[model samples]
Target: MPAQVICIGSVLWDIVGRTPRNMALSNDVPGRILRLPGGVALNIAQALAKYDLSPVALTAIGQDTEGDDLMKASADLGLDMQFVHRPDDLPTDCYMAIEGANGLIAAIADAHSLEAAGDAILAPLTDGRLGSETSPFSGVIALDGNLTLALLQEIAQNPLFSNADLRIAPASPGKAERLRPFLTHSRGTLYVNLEEAGILVDRLFDSSQDAVRALLDAGAARVMVTHGGRDATFGTPDLITSQTPPKVNVTRITGAGDTFMAAHIAAEIQGASPSDALNAALAAAASYVSGDTILS
Candidate 1:
């Protein structure tokens, strides 16, 4: 049976501006600019599709023209999006970014709509559509930190996730601290970068291994910390391992982490061991970042 995945978090469009040449402040160079559907949950869901998970998104978007178009784009991709909440007053969220040859230059995210929607997006779970507090949704759930701290705490303590296997990703370093609530959850697996891992562990880490160890010691059952192009560490109850990511020509910087998270979750759902899952995740992320145009 295909693993049932509930992707809970933001769903929005990303506008990225790229430059082939190295850049800095006041440097204006010509490069390709593209727009695509991207958000923590949406990105993971899209990447999970590649692994045949067909995740259903639990998110909210506005009823604006852009929102309609983005929904159409999603439908074209065959994402099972029955859980998305559409509000008339709210405007769909969007993110914009600029990237140079060196790396990411600047980025701005406008996810206020999602933040304002709050637990309303999770109606399915509360209203017995997805699951309830009494009988929570089972199967794998890719949870994001884009949710408010209150909601995160609720999820951590609520019975809704008592039977669910959770794969979590912090939407960004700013909100990474929100996941601290889940440190004690038995079913949680954290996928984070070095800096964000430090936020959760409340200290600085010298290496990926250090971060993973600290997070594991701080009550996380399993932790995977990625140090950019450096070695990625996986720490679990049984073992700790590290794997280097294959070098790839960097075309874009966004969505790479989500790609890794999604692939890892899918691999685990398919019964891959931790080491095998990490390797598969790195390979999928390398392929995703190396080039655009992932041919289905």
Candidate 2:
């Protein structure tokens, strides 16, 4: 399939440990452990693929066993890997997370390889291959904050991105500050959770609506703020819309935000109204967390 969008950031293996009971520090419980292909960009891409949107990955992977396996997995999921950067010297990246009944306990992302690969990962966009500054790729680009802050900053002002519709994700709250540059990009839209929005705005917001306003005030062109089990809001300088996510038992939380972001993007691409898009995204996320098969 041809690429409908480009996903730029970490493409790695996810080692997840999930338990049905609440857990604390040093608490070991019966749980399920699984290894899956995951990353901010990959998660969003996988979800997009579910909507039959082919996304091309533009991240660095290694030439090792893990990288080979990840490539096969991404292919099986229908992601376009032809543009992915694979360096022989760098080892494959990975993320480990433990989720308990209450919520996420901890996560560690080993994305040093991605950061080290640097601008090399973006060569395809600049080398007159997939696209170039003279003829920029004028499609949607899903970017994750796993890339270094310097690269993110460059991308914010780079002419190569001038014509693209950019969708940015902070990857995690710890990396939220890295998205500062994109806040001012005219065509960029940020997908963040309540805490991530607070980190970006330097203030605590009591609700997603408040966070949406704060983010727009902080110079973000557009923002979507989601609060776990609460209302989520999408805001622009001129309009703000809020909707409650459908109530569901959250059996997992790792990739719910990405699912919401992907679903929303898909809905908009298919010409859904803003209200319909938000409802579709919320419904998809609710289904994801409820461990149901997402049909959207």
Candidate 3:
């Protein structure tokens, strides 16, 4: 089937170590480690697939054995991988994170291969395979901040994305500023946490409501801000909606934001109102963090 959505950015393995006890600096604890197919774009794509949306993942994967395994794993999740750029030079990227009961202690993202691949992965979008300059892709597009600043800037202004419904997210707080270019995109909706929103605006926000309103005032077309287990708000210039996520034990913190974004997108596409969509997203995210949703 043709693609209903396009997920662009890092696509690789996620090695996460989760421990039940709270941890602090220089502390090592016994935990379970799982290597899963992840990355902001891939996570969102996987969630979209579960919603019956055919998503095409556009990113770089090396020709190494890890890349081969990752491709097979992603295909098994119902993602369209035919348009991915597979170069023989770079090795598949990976992200490692240590999550304790308190939260994410530290993480390292080895996405150099994706950064080096750059705009090459987007060739299919402009080469008539999915779309061209004259006939651009008008479907829903999920983008992540794992890309270099230059490429993200180009996409913010590129006509190829002008007609698409863009949903942008930062891969992590460290990469949050990379999404600055799309702050004013007419059709873009940013999914960010309270800290990530503060990074983009350069000011600390007290709550999701404050952050969402501040982002709208700062020229963002639309935005969704989540403040951990507090509350999440979705806002536009004229209207704003808020939803408090159901409280649950957060056993894992890795893909919660991506799940929220994907669930919101799916709800909106199914003609849900903005308020209902926010609720649905928060519910899905709560399930993910509570370890109630199984990852394939």
Model 2 spans > 4 angstroms off: 1-3
Tens digits of per-residue lDDT for model 3, 1-296: 53499999989999999999999999978989999999989999999998988989999999999999999999999889999999999999999999999999999999999999999999999999999999999989999999999999999999999889999999999999999888855559999999999999899998999999888888889999999999899999999998889999989999888999999999999999999999999889888999887344
The lowest-lDDT stretch of 10 consecutive residues in candidate 2 is 287-296
Which candidate has the top score in lDDT?
3
Instruction: Estimate the Cα RMSD of every predicted model relative to the unseen true structure.
Output: 1.6, 1.5, 1.2
Q: What would the TM-scores of all predictions be?
A: 0.96, 0.97, 0.97
By the lDDT metric, which is better: model 1 or model 3? 3
Which ranges in model 1 have alpha carbons more than 4 Å from their true place?
184-187, 292-296
User: lDDT by residue for model 2 over 1-296, one digit each (tens)?
Assistant: 44498899988999999999999999989999999899988999989899989888999999999999999999788789998999999999999999998999999999999999999999999988779978999889999999999999999999999888899999999999999998766559999999999998799989999999988887888889999899999989999999998888889988888899899999989889888999999999999999986521
**Winner on TM-score (1 vs 3):** 3
Error of 2 at 115 (Å): 0.6
Model 1's TM-score against the true structure: 0.96
